[model samples]
Target: MVVKLKLEELKLASVVFHHLWTRRNGLIFQDVFQSPSTVTTMAQVDHVMYKEVLTKDSERTARRQTNEFSQSWKPPAWPFYKVNFDVAFDQASGRMGIGVVIGDSEGELMECLIAPKKHVPSVFQAESYALHRVMELCIELGLSQVCFEGDAKVVIDAVNSKEEDSSWYGQKIEDLQQIMAGYPEWKIVFVHRTANVSAHTATKLAIRVSSENVWLEDDPVEVRRSIMDDLVCNVLNQS
Candidate 1:
């Protein structure tokens, strides 16, 4: 018996059958015989089956694209003499801290973090706040080429990809993007937590300080001192 199938339906059915056969399962002739009406008249099932197949194909295509994009994506490299900044925030104490370590292709040049009191709720929020603070610091330092590093993946991805604009912090993300746009050269990077230790310490200290007090320094003496003391204590205990 000849069946008249829609062009789209025939293509979809061929695709579906190819996939099914690849799994080592042959089509059941008995099933087709049982559904004689459907098998003999493509009009009986073509429209519904075509839509279902189309949707499945579309979803598969989208997933493949997402995977490809992720695998190929890489952060831009820092330029020579670029100003690099690391920022951290404390949500509990509502304090934001930024540790900027400027360097060139040569080596480390300068470093600083500001402990400013502000109300923040979560680590993610603190990360974003730190980024905003870094931009301000960059402008203040009169540096046009700057790179920012943060431990928070969410914030970095939001700022770099421009995908977070539809989220809760969408407005803030857009604002930061605009601010960064003013600079001829600006880059944001996601770094390992270990590399961000100084900024993390600065953020903790910043939260401890009162709102009236804002700690600004080129060198983070207090944080360095605390680390030294911890190391010394550990050595003494081992002895």
Candidate 2:
């Protein structure tokens, strides 16, 4: 019959049983036998190693769970600002729509911009241009400590990398790197689409607006709602 056991007790019993099986195999296959004391010592060593493996597995599981719960927008640390950028494209018109959102440590909107660019060669160029626009705006606004975020993993990775990019958009990435070098405290990060709702919404808005749209401490209704939803998700996840 089977019975439930406390974690430690079960682990000890499993290790002991495993080593006992190994000892039996040695007797049959190799015609070798060890004393009871020797077998017990081997089992004890297996138990210690098994416990260490279990501990590491438990730690990895915990870290993964934490990351899953934190899949929403979060405020930056004190004295720092967070910027999120995104892009949308119209194939028919060959125009790329760009959106950028900036927020303070309190999650309060500082500024936002939605602009349309025409004759962009590719989506990669569009994403890269959006990041470049962010750098210019941050510098113009005099934001010294800023954390730039985007849903474009490729663009973010290229910006963070030290190696030279030789792709079609390599020159743009190089220009961005040179500009970013002047501000040592600024950084760019990649986030999931769900966590970048506000900026993504602004990109959708860019499709309708004829000229560039800028908001100071406020945003369009759709973008504002998205930001509020992020705040709500952040609070729920924390609680």
Candidate 3:
């Protein structure tokens, strides 16, 4: 007999098998018994996290191999700050992670946020929410001559579109436009995921945290490493 499984089905089976093995070990050594629902939920979460890691790795590789000269993270001009935003969504849990990082021309981290949003309807909505929230933050901080960057091409295109948006997230896009109109010096652009690694790292970290955390010049080690990677790459590209 031959068995055929779709890509998603194969991934689900793998996650389920891994979780079952873990449960078996727990039962044998720890005398712990988890219900079927609990096991299934664990498998689902594992699958989501595994996929996220794989996606990020793939994006990083692709960005490096691409011929695009603008693939690397570049610092903004003097007196202008670059704000990068990214989102990670878990459809199984309706939870979304939002990351925003601000850096100066020297590629030094200025401000960053790692937060989670519950009941996010979809990935598109989640990305839109991140962008909107970052805009609010910039306004609150009185930041001008800002360059906003994100990995969501669709959201970036939508925000830059002059035509009206009537989709579910249209209102949010309209709000973003209104906010942009007020700050004429502010600009939003799309970037590859690898170029937004710090924000993306913060986004992944957001999923593990329960509350919003903001840092000023003090980012988590993982996020700090990403910023350093960008800075190093910028230096190499310049030389």
Considering every candidate listed, which one attains the maximal TM-score?
A: 3
Clashes of 2: 0
Per-residue accuracy of model 3 over 145-173 as CA lDDT, tens digit each: 89999877767887899988554356778
Cand. 3 TM to true fold: 0.73
Superior by TM-score: candidate 2 or candidate 3: 3
lDDT of 3: 0.84
Give the candidates in order of lDDT, highest first.
Answer: 3, 2, 1
- Per residue, candidate 1 scores C-alpha lDDT tens digits across 1-239 of 99999987686567445334422321353231213332323322233444644675676588678863211111224453343344445433445655444444333344455556464434455667767777776787776766666556666787788464444466777888889888758777776444445456666555555542333334457655633443444455547
Full-model lDDT for every candidate: 0.53, 0.81, 0.84
Tally clashes: model 3. 0
Question: Candidate 2: where are CA atoms >4 Å away?
Answer: 1-70
Worst 10 residues of 2 by lDDT: 44-53
| Location of the lowest summed lDDT over 10 successive residues in candidate 3 | 41-50
Q: By TM-score, is 1 or 2 better?
A: 2
Best by lDDT: 3
TM-score of each: 0.51, 0.70, 0.73
Which scores higher on lDDT, 1 or 2?
2
